[model samples]
Target: MWHELFLIPFLTGLLLAVLLPVLGAYLRLREEWLAALAYAHLAAGGALLGLIGSLPPAIGGVGAAVLAGVGKRLFAARLSGGAGYALMLLGGWAVAVLVAANHPLAERLGHAMFDGQLYFADAAMLQLVVAGTAIGLLVLWRLSQQLLLAHLYPDFFRIRGLSAWPTQLGFDVLAALSLALATMSLGVMGAFALVFIPPWLAFRRAASWRAGICWSLVIGLAAYLLAFSLALYFDQPFGPMLAIVLVFFGVLIA
Candidate 1:
């Protein structure tokens, strides 16, 4: 009972603390923070598809994210940002509800994905998340130099023969994959909070890249701890509570 209810929740929060800040910082710097919500909805929709069709959860989640990423890339030249991302977010969320509408376990699954009940997470699921996050961090670390150059010196790339498409593609794929994994592991709400809140706080205060990420990690960890403690004491849902905690801190810090 303790393991099922407490241990997994704690572990998941810890894992998210370290992982999300890095991913969040990258997204904020890239000006793709809105895409996090988009990918999260896509992951939720894809997870519902997996449930309805008996596919692997990650397959559906990652597939939807990749499709969205590709679509964004293709339509970026045409569609304006606000309209494009808004339509995609609505589409993804609508698909999720539609998929879950007639399922036998609709309520339960919907609650799981939307609420992200941390107590219900299993060890295997948590481990998979940890492994995936680890690999993602490594990939980001490897691309750090190029990503910095691209962000700070777009003209520098054009001056060279570097089209920069490959770098963009790599980052997009990684972000999509990370969003998918996080959605599956942490639920849509949890994933959004982790990806959005920390970075929002980090960017406002930090003077340098390293300082920004460090502060993000600190803020994320605090949010996770506070949420966990509050949930345990008040008998509330961990993910939503964490989101609330993050918002509270965001207000205070802002």
Candidate 2:
């Protein structure tokens, strides 16, 4: 278990355990939590398409998500209240399933994407997770003030003769990258669970916004560690175990 094979995958999951919940906290703040699932589904679809096209799955997945994030700005007015994200989720799911049904390899890859292949994660995944985490934290730190202002005081930017387009676009790309990478590592529902569950509990229980973020990180990290151990011990799939553990944590706190 302590070999390089397990150690690398564990480290990959560790980075994501911390990163996904932080991203989730911000998404929840903006009332855009659906972006997580949308991006995950899209990444899964892109990954399957990539496998068929002989492109690197990560490249395909990330490329598709980044494109959607950038393109979202164009349709922002027409698709209010997450309707666009919901559409993306449904479209991506349909594409992935259709591709899987038609292609033998895609079918196997689709199961892996949904069920997760964390124990088989290689050093390349660790590198990607490490890079993604660093970039995500840096972007979040630099844009944190603007992001809060944009959400909490929507008029603040408009009143100050500032366009929040750059900030919104930057964060959208950041979120797309984070969710796509997480979906690849943790599977669709597993990644969405990490993004959805911990921040949810924190929002209800924490005293302040910053406190909610802190509590979200703590809950996500704790649940991820427990799920990793249990899944290994029981010889079960890690993704479902993670989602289950997170829901159980939510139940306990609720």
Candidate 3:
């Protein structure tokens, strides 16, 4: 399995294993983890529409997610907290299923998006993941302090006569892009699992914010590798296996 054929997909997964958890740590901090599932579901819908229109699925998915992220920020007053994400999630799911129901090819692609087609990931997917990971890391590095202050004190920037929308919007777009790519590679629930579980576990155990991030990264990477190997060995689906492995890890730690 460690041959030329699997190299690209493996590399894609590895990069996501590093990036997603870092994003997840922040999402968990902001208590906005539901955004992962919302963005993923939207990506699935966009991907299905892309197939129907003969466009690249990744482009459609990422575009839709980024739009939603931007819109959420712009309408922050009305779409506050998880309400906006919930709306996106339901709309996305409805769109995806409705599209799949009418088109045969879209049905298959939609299923693949939810179930995951990691082994079928091509070079384009790997390249996209590489670029996304790099951008995510760079932006996260710069926004670390602002994000920390925002999450810890919600009013830190506001009280000081600064708007927090810019930072929140930036992170929102970054997270939307990250989850879209992960969904394309790891399936909807697989991506959500990575964004939710590791950080949940890390927050319970870590002594500080930095330690939480480190623990989240370690937990995500370990589960990802184990899940990948186990799925390949057992000839099972990757997404479900990854989720299962993560849950088991969560149980062990909890």
Model 1: how far residue 120 lies from native, Å: 2.1
Per-candidate TM-scores read 0.92, 0.98, 0.97
Candidate 2: clashing pairs of residues:
none
- Tell me the TM-score of model 2: 0.98
Candidate 1 lDDT for residue 25: 88
Candidate 3 matches the true fold with a TM-score of 0.97
Instruction: State each candidate's clash count.
Output: 0, 0, 0
Q: Pairs clashing in candidate 3?
A: none
Candidate 2 — which residues are off by over 4 angstroms? Answer: none
Ranking by TM-score: 2, 3, 1
In model 1, the number of clashes is 0
Native-to-model Cα distance after best TM-score fit, residue 235 in candidate 2, in Å: 0.9
Residue runs of model 1 more than 4 Å from their true location after superposition = 1-5
The stretch of ten residues in a row with the least summed lDDT in candidate 3 is 1-10
- Specify the highest-TM-score model's number: 2
